[model samples]
Target: MRFARAIALGAVTAVTGGLLAAVPAAAQATGAPAASAAATVSVTLTGKAVRADGRAVDEVGVFVVPAARWVDEDAAPVSTALVADNGRYSVTASVAAGSSLYVRVDDWTSSDGYMDRLFVGKGGKAAFTYVGLAPIAAKAGTIELGTATAPKLSTVRVTTSAPVHCAKLLRKNGTLAAMECDYTVDKKVFTFTGMYPGEYTVGAMWSSWTDARATVDVSAKKGVTTAAMLTLESPTTMTGVVQDTQGKALEGIAVWANGPDSPRTVTDATGRYAFKGLTAGSYVVDYSGASGMSSAYRDYVTRTSTVSVTSGRVTTAGSTLTKGAQVTGSVTPLAKETYGTIVALAADGHVLASDSYWSSDGKKRDFALHGLPTGTHTVVVQDAASGRYAKSTVVVSGTSARTVGALKPAAAPVTVRGTVEGTTAGFVSLRYGTSPLYRGAIDGGDVKPDGSYAITHVVPGIYALRSHRTTSTAGYEGNLLSVTVGDGVAVRRIPQPTRKVQTLQTLVRTSVTFDGRALPGVVPLPRRTPADLWGNWTNEKGVGQAPWTGRAWDAVVLEDVFFAYHSPYYFVVKSPTSVTKPGDLANVTVARVAGGPTV
Candidate 1:
């Protein structure tokens, strides 16, 4: 699986010195490779960004990164700047003036609000040119980069059968998008407006039934409206009673579905348990607390039962239990690099889909355990030699998608730093020790955008430097850096190696190893540490890396103002008390970030 990468060496005629007739690597989702062109020219793109309603955008991140980054996402920019106060942008980037390149914003902060990864110039179809552009002169100036119209929210209306109450909108990434949604009982429609462009699914309850597939896959394009109708055929329900050897009904026993997607509930006083809103599928149900049904049933340990459910149908697989108490649960991992990653469940299991089912967000990383009749049922999560953490613990609980959180690296608090490329912003980290790995970093404030960084409060030990940029691009490679702190010692700059983005994963998974003799997990930053996150954040799982904030480094979760999905994101308004609806917004204005917008 070699990824097609464009090496933009010292400004040349074409992106990679010259364009190759055939690319040996596979093109990524961002866009295609740049074609060849003469280096005899330079380009200066001038433009302004505005909303669909003709309002100017200012101070947004306006730059010329690699034209290939649009396709090969990990690629960083070569030249950068901000849109001016008057909504005008001028940048003379070093590109083969005639070659194809991309000019856009990586993250956007506009009048309505902020979008983490927004792209302008994606209008016309030249494929992935961000809406391809025309070539310019050898140093062309103010060539009208064109206006990027801010994307408006999409209204997705989900129609279900009858008065199916309670519908939720979740990001395709498996995170909740809208909570406690409002629905129209008469029309059986759950409508959510003010949505950004992305994929979403409906995770909600139907009338008297709960369904995993209550809605089809719905995509929202900016300024577009979409509707998905989920026809509830024959709704299905599975009901059965749990009993002891004496046939006495077992009460208060918890029956849980092995897959995190399924629902769980307690048996009734009559020892009866039921599951509703089920589609035809194989399910594993395990019980907790049944060792005491009666003297005759006291020695029985319940085995996991296999039940198959079909669309609009029910299947029951209940069992009688002797005396036994056990614990089990599901683990959900949250990143792309999270695939092939094995997770260690303390009792006796790892994240294997065939047994532990993968989730729908992307490639699912789900796992559960049965058989644990005795022992502390600690929900600890360990990585499969491929994840960032050597081991993580499931700290929070709740089986529902939004409520459940797990598989995060344990925190390590030592400090360390180095200059990988002495270039770009310092959005870097340092991970050390071995399994139960420790991830720590130098303060973002200590690391300059030029890449010069420093780490204080170091725990004397050996560590590894992991980065994605090359020396050519000003990044470091994975290698060992030893720190020895005497009673009173000054910190020194650790030497860096070459950075290879292509091999970053390999370094992350293979090349790097911890000193091992210490505690197993990620180290934390110095206390009172304030880091940076580029834009808005949804409820992300696990403390992890974030986009560079052009400022001091940050921790996993930071403090910020959050609003509800239905709440308006204001830029400027007539008066706080004067505006309440869309009509009231007609005359208000907002103060942009960094004096960003042109008044």
Candidate 2:
């Protein structure tokens, strides 16, 4: 298969010149178009195309493909460029901010034969070298990819026992590459050429058989084809019989295999139902359509009454349907609402069925839910307009209609107040449970500077008081505080998660003096060698500047602060240290004011 071919540039929208102001000067270098910026972020990739032996390569087609669409067959590059004879190339692509992009360098037409490499950044680390790893975060700047070494490409020959419908190759780093099955041949082979040297997982799918997956490693040389064999397993099967509690066969009962594909069928005259072509796994066999019979589920094999099918084997699960019960309830309108919705939920919180009631006068309306299996269910009644709701648990058994007395919906919502510790700048909302039938924030409030927040008009129910900090990225969620709100005012103190210290450093160019004195009212700074002077800093106020001959002295003064998130340097100050080189400041140390912003 052809790996690299000409791609049309029409798909890439042209960036406006006004957006070029944000492009770095390095992107405007010769042999490449001047970088332009617009509403979308732009990444300027600069790299050298070299052979494995480090020789400059010419005529190499370098492209930046969006990582999200890399597996697509017709995915086009956002930007493409050819390697200069000097091996250096630069390509700029306008992409969405924070988006990831893949850098691919290829020259399949060369006499060297399909030599290619995918740029994973320097030292093969996923770290951001201007742009981050695999999904290179689309930062609007230049990404200095020092060199891209095109080692001889390798191939992966994937084979399977059954006719493969499709296949996919997954890299160890979670990069997916689609592979085409060789249908013209035996249909069992999927050859992926021009693969980078690494560990890859090969997956093959068959129409009526269980799919297969195998891991293989492709070598780092040309003419080497890694062989991977995926032996397809036979599809699993589940057969069952549905009968009445009296041991009589129940014909025409729908037995549903609630597993992959959710295959369903009706029982024959013998009360036997079979479901084939299923993957090996646990299955929840359910039968519900029998007249007046209770719905049931078989989750295990043998005495457990459930089913789990294995490859080429059959698992049997027979269910005996009993008489189902019914539930009847009346919802009393707490306010002026005339209609309400009634829902019956299983113990697992799945809605069994829903029914509505309407009344011309503001009086109680009746509702009925039938065909409930022998189990515990929570019946809920909700006012359509006022958002008031009430729920009660009912036990359903036998054929009688269980009557739940009238349920009065809750009255007006309540006011909730709390002290939000740790962060003082975010919003506080409530995630209500289903009993209230309202999930969103009826009313959310911003945390005051004093760390107090109040949410008004909150419905009465169990809720999770969620807090967020908009101050910094280090902001984390406090432990979920489950609160039960009633008609009165509720108050609680929620402590936010602690903030971790992030070490930040920046190079500060200044003169250092060897005066054995410390600034007044300031504590002695941490003693360390000049090499270890770089630490966390918050701000810099230049005091003075003087020209020093010799090697320009760049002194690093480390300070700890709470406001620094982005940027390398935080705090800077000018002192009377006159040193030619960084080594001259071996005895120099700095001090910080007591209780100052920079500790």
Candidate 3:
């Protein structure tokens, strides 16, 4: 109970400091004595640290940070000892009667650091009362010692019934932790444990690697005795035949079992290939060459069908390696370049995964490229020889390919022009739309002084125009406009939509109160004036009423009664001698005051 009180006080200090200062004292009063009389408690703490493979971690630091306040005030150690070379650690501490205890184990230097609380006593009925590096307990049951045996270490042996060399192994950490564990080369298996109970991810490394996760839980009664067994059995084999476009066997052509972890296999002279040791999942079969030739082979050969690998089942995936058209072209500026290197770029602007070649010609200017996929590609003729060059897009089809004309130097100047509206003075932004987009500033033209602007020397192609407002102006308007231009095309401006404004009106009212004692001549109530009162008002009797209705007793009396009743009526006074007539009130003009339904 004293320990509990101390913990409560510590929690309070951790939160709203000093808010619960009185709670600890009150708690101690209700619980057992703060210190027991003439009793000494002995406690022992111990644990082990090891690699995932269960090998004891040697010379590791394992200590505890005390959580309780020392009753003696001066009985606290600054530090504790390191564990033995065999990964075992122990600490003993004595406590006075009624003292509380808590223990923590951790390492600060290792990549895999850990911190945990150690429970003492059978039911974990002890509490932390004093601050110290060694474990402490109030009773003899406060600390219990145990050993952490390293789990058995083993490698996973994967073998496909068929020939496959590209299988992968993935661990619970979500990484292709191991490449193809070819049973033929690395027959050793891998095993890991000493992990707390939980779900873990286990899968193959390649695209075909099946995602198989396992769960482990260790019970308290089991202590450090827990084990898990995982057996990764190979799925069915997929057999296939690969041939060239001419129907000849394509020997050494690599075939891949694709999915999550795509594995690869090589075809035999008989044009036959097999992917073994696969799981039950969708897989793609690809035909290519070994590492270096993969890019070119990928360009020429493609997958034919997806095969399903099931347990003890066989799937067939026959495919052909087409002989794609081979293209050959020569670079003209190889000799005059400094690095004397030429690079070929694909239509998508990606550098071909091929090596750069130097022109063998004496001119040091002529370079040739062969075995290119039949398509349109940009032939970049850099001055590898002269260190200066130009690029031109060329189309390649048949086995023979060549440039039709000499490469010309790139034009340095291009024109940019556009129409602007609503803007008086601000810069327009010009940028290229495609890859390697060029960004530059353009000055506003004199067209509308505040409107359309134009800039010169903009490279030909589609360009984006953005308007920027000056600091003094409000802000830019409209979205970016795209403009296209041909070589030597005139500057042109696309029209921008004009901005418009809308107006609205609503009738608002005001209230006015008048006391008969404050103004004798004024009406004591509200009324509605004739719609044409500003111009003129005529009575049915043909009498012309004054526009102001000034200080008129009849007018006031009539208006007050009309507003009070909210209806047309003949004026009548409470006096019994008073007489009211229609014509008498007709000459009295009334006007509507501000508030709704004045009465």
Candidate 4:
């Protein structure tokens, strides 16, 4: 997810009723003239960062950068800070005369993270970058340094109904302040300070625990106490076996189960399989061979069974495999052909057997395939020797043998023939919507020197096509195309889009690095501003917007906010970085208030 800076540029006007009566002489030394000398101007920046459930984010990182360098190389951040505990922050900066400002806020928690970028001034309206994260921006608001109130701190108690694994609780600004754990029988508790009155969410993890989650709200007048109960449930197990058509134990044959709330599991080496932690529900057991043999060899054996597990219980089921029929065919190359190919496909387009061999003396070639189920089959023959092919369907009975007579080579289509360009040479499948109807490569199609080619005899329907290129030189490979196939459809040449084009730009709060490599996760900022600086800054005056540095590849805006910043005129620079996992960083670049935009 991308992170962005929120920058608001407005004229700093004097407070009402002579609030700036003691305007210091040094104020002019920083380039801002006195109230009487020039228009007394003030900027206020304020906003909130919370989870999707409206819980206040604590200790998240936030920053503000100039609009010019939000996504560029030059305009790096100039101001940064951590948000307070209440998910609210305020910053007030007195800008010199005739200057513009940009503000940005970013959260780096794994859930509902966001990076927002906005500009404030007479120059232009604010622009947003929705890379992967979503940001909320506050509209124009008045700021009174003299009347603003400091953020109040309070305490919150979090309790779980049952004993949980007890990971660590984190603030929105990506800070690990303390280590908390409890091995008690029933519950665990944690208290936080310097938190403003607001809604906050706590996350906990536990093993063998079920239905354990909760939320709480805190306020200054009445400190909030939240509790979550953990429920314990027993897990059920399923065991089964697989065998071949001759009633012999088929070791290593893959077996799987699919059903409500059950993930797929593979059988063991002894052809025995077991599914653990299965909730009380109905499940379907599916068995197949490692080579993916067709139903003829008992390709798939499925049984639906229900098991009621009370705490701990073992359920057992057995499966058997049956024999299928055999199919034999011949590949005859045309006069000018060089190679003969034959493929036997099932009703569902599963390749049961396929083989390609060099033509001997340019004569007809014979091939045989065993272990096929009794059913209708689609046979594809390609005579690469003469650049010709044909497709036909045949039926085979489990008890009898089936044969396909000599297939006469057909004339290639001249008017409608094209090749798939910009893709590696692999299987280019074409299918017509929600149906089992489709055709592979064109049997008889004209050839062109260029990759451009077309096809004929296309039926009418909503046709969707895609190419699976075995080898791809660029990211544009494996492209998909959707088209409408009405009666006598003629598809002209369509060009594929390249991946080099960028549709959006995103800004991130903190740069992440893993094993000395940059990862893609934002660092959160605090939501509340400091108490000492309260009443001296408006929410809008202290708002920060980070600029888009031409670095990070893709941004993942976390849901929590912990970082904070003041002054909309500052900027932060970011470079494209990637991380393999989370919480793996050794070095990072952070800029605090050094010489610019101080009250």
Candidate 5:
């Protein structure tokens, strides 16, 4: 008990800078008596946040962190809640009974900024000292911590001597904390509001060149504004002209400077193109134009040249265009599948040209690529729904148009099945490893309460199985398991054996509704907020049920966006209206919060 007391005190003091004044020293030290793991409890921390001047915060972000991870730089909130305009918040998170935890409160409202922008500290990292209390035991019911004081938010404004096309604010640790590009065109200034008082670096740029940088400290007082000025250095410029091999100026040719800012312009009447306000650097200038030979077809000329630009001086890079080749092809998609992008890739893996196809379009499934340099290219076509793709190699010689005939059909996609042992609180995904065919990880569905998972529409190949914790914002930790799928395997269960995941026998039948209308495609995120997703966002009707876990509250359901930005409507299940025991119906209704973000 004394060891527990010491660890609790050290952890809390390290986070809060002091002890909670409301709780007695003996109570803080003793905490709640240790309970067996089977006796894990759902604890609710209720509290209010006040500003330095003792005024109640309009809305505050309340978070609970386990003491074990309080010092971990990437620690995530075990549970999160938002205080109402009334300054009161109640958030629930499941923890082992007798576990010591920390409660944090900050001046982060959804209206002003994002959760990551809460408060900036030492290295431009989110500071956690605004309002914190810790070492509280995980009791079965609500625990009230008295009002905690937090600092007032601050604002900073930056002005530049010259017009800055872009600017960024850096944290003390040189991290690109923010680029609150709220630029005032007339004043050549940038405004950053609702920032935690601290030292920050401001860097301004014209085009892609760094003009100047300045450091300033934001005042800690409420409504006090910090201001800083940045002076510019001499500017750089890059100019170019384009003409055909016949010495004829190619007016209206597209000219591009591929460098820092990638400025682009079209050749004027004199075939001249200029890019001012550039950074001092080397640039590759590209010129492209088409010569009218006949109404049936036009020969396209494309050329490139490299030039170096110096500060306060104009550098010229000109190019004489030569006819380039074109690549044309047709694609045939699999039955019931739509065509995705058809890309012509060079041997170096750079995409030369790309176009899309649709099954619904009346035109033939034909694609064409113009202005391609004479080279060998791999023409690839992928199915939109399925990641299956086909590729064909073609060669273009001396401005001659090369044709790739109808591409062969891609191999059929396969399904993968696996079991995630130990915990039912996370999802399993199949990530492509060194597979040029697939682009990203295929959603393997959420690990069911029984720990079994099946992922469909996966391209047959070697893949890495990634386990993502449902309660943490930190995405896919590492490849926990590897899976190799072969063609013609309809449904192959991974060699990994299925293991039982412990669960609280309590089954809660729940139905979610928004504004009295039953909402479909809502995910049941047990004990966590909408910010932490379980990733099993398949279509489940409003009336769904799940077994409660030992390490979770009743449930928190959010509208499933299914790989897209989510809707703002969500609800927390405190208790059922009628039956409260195992295998009972838990009917819940969620109303949209007034003035909250809408879908």
Candidate 6:
């Protein structure tokens, strides 16, 4: 395409000015005079143009294509209009009483990641339909063409037992860029338009009837519409506190919810972690514990179960994470003529500790990997811009680390080109080195809008192809790809799998407890006044929650007097359905949190 931003002012003025502008004055004066009774045979074409997701599409060009030929003239457009933000457009054209036309959308750029400019007309597989104009005996005529939808994304409908409130359909990479909320308050089914065919997760907010958030994975097939069915269940909360072997709080530690939903958050100043709005399910709170070059000390984990969280209640899954060995190191790039460096200590392709070192105007690279898991790990380092780097493997004893003195040079340049088809706006990476922990990059760049990408000047060698969305998950379907490229372009199709990853089912939340003390999960600030809980919430009024952020409060009361305390309520769900009291669930065994075997 041809994209014309706006019609010229003079042409528009003349067309509206007199008959000489639209047609010859002598012909109009003889046959049909402009703005006269004979020329009053006009047709108004109007409609709303939209994207697949039901969002209004603006700046689309609309045309009235002639459906029936006139005397010696071919079928063609008699008028045009531009779609507005509300997706509405109106065009008035003068024609004979029996003249007919089809409403067609003209060429325009689509923001929905289509490579080519849009060509949506009759029989183009467009999601829109052209309306046929009929003869009008009245002076005024109107032809309502209804709605025109763009043919970009596939629509996925989520049918739930309860109406999903404030629900959003998340993409495979767990980002909102693919499709946000097609919220339904009381409707049982929610339709999410503007979705590319891929795996997705659908979740709803707090519901009055059932406790669970009704989160489910939709394994959308390629070119197939996904209609998912999910039921609501009881909802619950999980909380815990992590501390060092010396009983000191380890604030700012990363606590991950390893289950159906992998939502992660950091500990507060009190070393307490809280996970709210989760369906009752089995879950593990993996804390950042002792590892790497520790000061030659032994490590151990605590006790834990088939933890159950009850509906309309908070379940405490407290965990005591004893600090592990600390590993630290630095990176010194070989050359300064590059972008930056990403140094990671990876074990089994999972990054234990990672940090980036960008080139300053006059500084050298310094990267450190702290608390690397015990045993051996690959220290992968590469230039961010040029993809040149080095790697080495080292074994970590009790808290320990080693210096990877100098970096290695990158390989020769090669061109790797391929079509990357997925909803993820991800990039294709040409990586040279790989460990179970991480893939060391050689060079990488973004995939274009046309589903194609080319990494020029890549070092010619055998490299692993990794396509990744914004999230940690690689959007591509298959395993790590291996390709051999010479000095020129190498073509490959990286198939993105539509595999449905199973999330841990919701069970009663459980926490490991020893010595009769439950682990403290929800750390609450002191309740100072009535305004803190009731209303007039202010961030600066010393609500006792200044330093702590991202905390999920169980409940606040304005009863006699609201006094903020320091500790959150810790409730551990020993069992959900079987346990009325603490003694009813002795059958569900427990594992002592001891030193886990080093990988």
Clashes of each: 49, 20, 53, 112, 0, 55
- Which 10 consecutive residues of model 1 have the lowest summed lDDT? 505-514
lDDT tens digits by residue: candidate 2, 1-599: 23322111111111133110112323321222212322477678777777766666653222343321112212455677878877798888877565545565554443453443333432322210112222344578887767666555567777776655566665322223445654322277777665544445566644223344434533323447778877665546677777766888866676655544456566766777666557777766656553212233211111113468887787777887665677887888766547767766665344455678877777878887766767787887777676677878899766667988898877565678988876677777775443222223345678898889998755555667767664322344455567877668999788864433222223333322211221111111222222223322111221112222233334433222211111111112234244454344333333211110100
TM-score of each: 0.35, 0.34, 0.34, 0.32, 0.39, 0.35
List model 6 lDDT by residue over 208-240, tens digit each: 222244568775442246798777664466677
Q: Give candidates' CA RMSD values in order.
A: 24.0, 19.1, 29.8, 18.6, 18.6, 25.8
lDDT of each: 0.39, 0.50, 0.37, 0.38, 0.51, 0.43
Candidate 3, which ten residues in sequence have the lowest lDDT sum?
A: 6-15
Q: Write the per-residue lDDT of candidate 5 for residues 234-279, one digit (tens) a residue.
A: 5576766677678777677777666555676677666776666776
Per-residue lDDT of 536 in model 1 = 21
lDDT by residue (1-599, candidate 3, tens digit) is: 01111111011111013111112333231222344453665655565544334545443221222222212211233234466666666666665544444333233332232112222221222111111112333455434445433222222333332233344333222222234445332232333221222222333322233332322221111113223333444446677787767887766676756563456666766778665556658875555542213343434423346667666677877777654433344444333433333334454443332224443443333444444456776654443323244556667664445552555333444456555655565556664442222222222333346576666544344555555553321233345566664566446554443322111111111111111101011121112333322212222122222223221223232222111111111122221121133223322322212111000
Clashing pairs in 5: none
lDDT of 1 by residue, 252-280 (tens): 66676644236666676788877666655
User: Which of candidates 4 and 6 is the stronger one according to TM-score?
Assistant: 6
- Name the candidate, 1 or 2, with the larger lDDT value: 2
Q: In candidate 6, how many Å is residue 153 off? A: 47
- Give the per-residue lDDT digits (tens) of candidate 4, residues 175-211: 2222245533223555443332322335454422222
Q: How far is candidate 1 from the true structure (C-alpha RMSD, Å)?
A: 24.0
What lDDT score is found at residue 425 in candidate 2? Answer: 73
What are the runs in model 1 whose C-alpha is more than 4 Å off? 1-37, 40-42, 53-70, 110-139, 162-227, 240-252, 256-287, 290-311, 314-599
